[model samples]
Target: MPVPAKRRSSSKGRRGRANKGLAKKTLAKCSKCGKPTMPHHVCPFCGNYQGKEIIKSKVKKKAGSKK
Candidate 1:
């Protein structure tokens, strides 16, 4: 394996690391519920996709006192 001829400078290393940072995620609004979601994906809040219900939402039911 060919090794580097000279030690990399700190400025050069820093410059390369700068572009490694993550970019902000792009979000789209759900037409039915008006919630922010990833484009072409089902809405997590309401289980909807493209203005239609694809997966049934698992809503927690209120627990009642058992006698």
Candidate 2:
């Protein structure tokens, strides 16, 4: 087994992590709702994918509940 001779410095570690920041997700417009969404995914706002309805998203009611 091998071991490091000395402890690593914080500056050196930070330099390596300089480019580790997360990149913003690329968004594509939903064909049906025309809203921004991730590519190749069902639209969360309208529950449609590739111009067709796929997963049925829950609908939110305004103000008080009907029941």
Candidate 3:
């Protein structure tokens, strides 16, 4: 059986693992609401995609504020 000839250094091991960390999410500005959102996806704030309304975002009312 083959085995490691020398013990791997902690710094080298950490360096290798550095690339394994989570990457930052790529986001684009919403055309309608001007909010940050994922590219090619519907804007959660305005529900617009590619300058069109894809989702009809509804405004939620406070439970205590009733007519």
Candidate 4:
């Protein structure tokens, strides 16, 4: 193995480590529900993706009906 006998190698290693903020992830909003969600993924709040509903969020409310 060849050893580095220069100061250039130390600075090069830190360059990549200091630029992590440039690669921050961004989340997109759903057009239907107006909620933040990952890009290219189905919106969990309204269960929609790509102008289509992928999942349904329906809850049946029980009525206190006296028989």
- How would you order the candidates by TM-score, starting with the best? 3, 1, 2, 4
Poorly placed runs, candidate 4 (over 4 Å): 1-23, 58-67
**Would you list the rank order by lDDT, best first?**
3, 2, 1, 4
Candidate 2 local lDDT, 22-57, one digit each (tens): 689999999987889999889988789977888765
What lDDT does candidate 3 reach at residue 28?
A: 98
Clashing pairs in 2: none
lDDT of each: 0.80, 0.82, 0.83, 0.75
Model 2, stretches more than 4 Å misplaced? Answer: 1-9, 12-19, 60-67
Q: Which model scores highest in TM-score?
A: 3
Q: C-alpha displacement of 38 in model 1, angstroms?
A: 0.7
TM-score each candidate.
0.60, 0.59, 0.60, 0.49
* lDDT for residue 39 in candidate 3, whole number 0-100: 95
Q: Is candidate 2 or candidate 4 better by lDDT?
A: 2
Every model: Cα RMSD to truth: 7.3, 6.9, 5.9, 7.9
In candidate 1, where is summed lDDT lowest over 10 consecutive residues? 58-67
In candidate 3, what are the lDDT values of residues 1-67, reduced to their tens digit? 9999999999999999999977999999988888899998988877889988888765323333567
Kindly list the per-residue Cα lDDT of model 1 for residues 1-67, writing each as its tens digit.
9988998999999999998887899999989888798999998777889778897765312122333
Model 4 residue 44 lDDT? 76
